[model samples]
Target: MQRTRHWILRRLSHLDLILLALVLLLLGISVAVVASASGQSPARISGHLVNVGLALSLMIVMANIPPHLLSKVGPVLYVAGVVLLVAVAVFGEIRNGSRRWLNLGVMAFQPSELLKLAVPLMLAWYFQRNESGLRGKHFLIGGALLAVPFVLILRQPDLGTALMIGASGFYLLFFAGLPWKIILGGGVLAGASLPVLWGFLHDYQRERVLTLLDPASDPLGAGYHIIQSTIAIGSGGLFGKGWSQGTQSQLDFIPERTTDFVFAVFGEEFGYVGTILLVALYLSIVARGLVIAARAPTLFGRLMAATLSLNLFTYVFVNMGMVSGILPVVGVPLPLMSYGGTALVTLLLGMGILMSVATHRQLNKT
Candidate 1:
């Protein structure tokens, strides 16, 4: 029995079992919450489960990839993402006044999702190559690399995805030790450009910001989502009304209850206690990812792991804030908890890359 245990441990030494456990726990919670939120829709639950399966399969595959091979392919993946984004601009299908998806005969796909991983991967690879002497000009080059996809996705009018992708790249640059003077100067310029930014916002986008400031102004219109979500959350109290028993969701008052507002569903069903548990699980995953990043042997591995972890943090923070009415609705989904295949798959792939970094380093050390 001792020899068997030792053999198993040696075989699985590369895996971050704690992070894997956290991921599984979150996925379990997501499946349950999605089932409750979907109500009578059995297909929704099955589809979500299928997505989880596919995502997990991909995660395992990516976790086994060698670090050097990933570095070599990073630029290729990024270039592919850029090409897809351009294709969407020229020959994409329009949905609800936004050209964000490309219909490829059998299926429609969003290119912006690809940038979420590719941007960070490419940036990490770039900085890894220039690790010895990164200067102000190199930072400028990095910003330009970040801006191209950011602008393209923003043109797709997917502000949420564009911002998410841009944030991932920015995290790498910041982690690469960008100077404080540049950070302060950029902050000042961003503040000065506020009016210009407002001018560029679409009417609906502007309305979202206004609604965030004063949701009461359009309670039944623009502010309806926030109002209903908050009501659901507040009514759940300390112990909740019970699984699938929330009146707001069952009565069809909460909007987007399965996607962006799914957290609200979980909150209403399981209340404050459940929310605390879920948040802790999320933080554990983030913390574990950071530990892996800190232990990474190569600069590329460290940057990628850190950026991916922070990007996960951004998703959780934005989704919770949007649902709780603290931030403007940006359609950011709660990582792992939201019922969307694209975002879920992209996120899992990133976590897999982090796992790859950790495992690859361990294998090299052995």
Candidate 2:
């Protein structure tokens, strides 16, 4: 009992209060959005609350792990994530025209979410192991590892998640000190491959790109969501319409209001001021994450932490852009504010790993 108290005190001192406060603020905002978006669906709100509780518990557990242990386990976790993704490809349940979830009797799991963390973990471990002097071969091998799971996820036709995973891995490569010329060359190659990739996209995928090019062409078809979302955002003006009072959401003009389109709901009800405040909260989280990454005790910790931080930013950017019609509709959720068990869990787990890095740095500094 005495030893337990001592250990608790030692670990508790490392907690990042600012990050936690921002997280809680986001949670508070999420509850409001979920309630408004769900309209009388008590079940969804309850489920989200439960998921948040579970995720927070997991974050606490992750924060307790030592940096050395996290580094050692990174590869193991990565392999496990990859194996699960493979299993999902072979024997997964298909939903909404995509085979992305694995049923575990009681609940469904998305392995792609696991890859968001695992990719960074694996890359961090690899780069740290080979950090003495990286080379072209090392970059090639890293790209291959990232491409394997990315290809598998893309085959699942979950473009949003696949893109996130790819970004997470790419961040590690960038942080590993890859040359600017190589990076530019890779970008040029990707741009050149667009035509080939376009030829292979599914019908709906093609429609989305087309809609993005000219949203007014199909006002009631592929363009309905963006048009509606844009209206909601514009109507909010500067001060917003007030909570639970946005006509677009209240009248059900916005599809996926509680999920992908929640940001629209937020914009309609809270307006530009609300949007700015929300952005500030996200910015705070990102800033804290960068600090943790910069002060991380080792190369692996720094890479993993930075990748996770940037990945969170990508989630915000992509989701907001898609809902606003600046980007095509891909089913990316707005981090904690969106209602989905799998996404909430994945987000919280990523935060856990970030907290783990932050905790490690604090311990070492002491």
Best by lDDT: 1
Taking the tens digit of each residue's C-alpha lDDT, what string does model 1 give over 112-179? 89889888888888888998988888899899999999999999899999889888988999998889
Candidate 1 weakest lDDT stretch, 10 residues: 7-16
lDDT of 2 by residue, 1-366 (tens): 999999888776555677778898998899889898888478988987898898877777777787667778878988898898899999999998899889999988888888877788888888899999889999999999899889999998898889989988888899888789999998999999999999999999999999999999999999999999999999999999999999999999999999999999999999999999999899889989999899887888888888888988999999999999899999999998998877888788778778878877756555
Residue-level error in angstroms, candidate 2, position 148: 0.7
Candidate 1 regions with alpha-carbon error over 4 angstroms: 1-14, 364-366
| Candidate 2 RMSD computed on C-alpha atoms after optimal superposition onto the true structure | 1.8
After best superposition, candidate 1 residue 163: deviation in angstroms?
Answer: 0.8
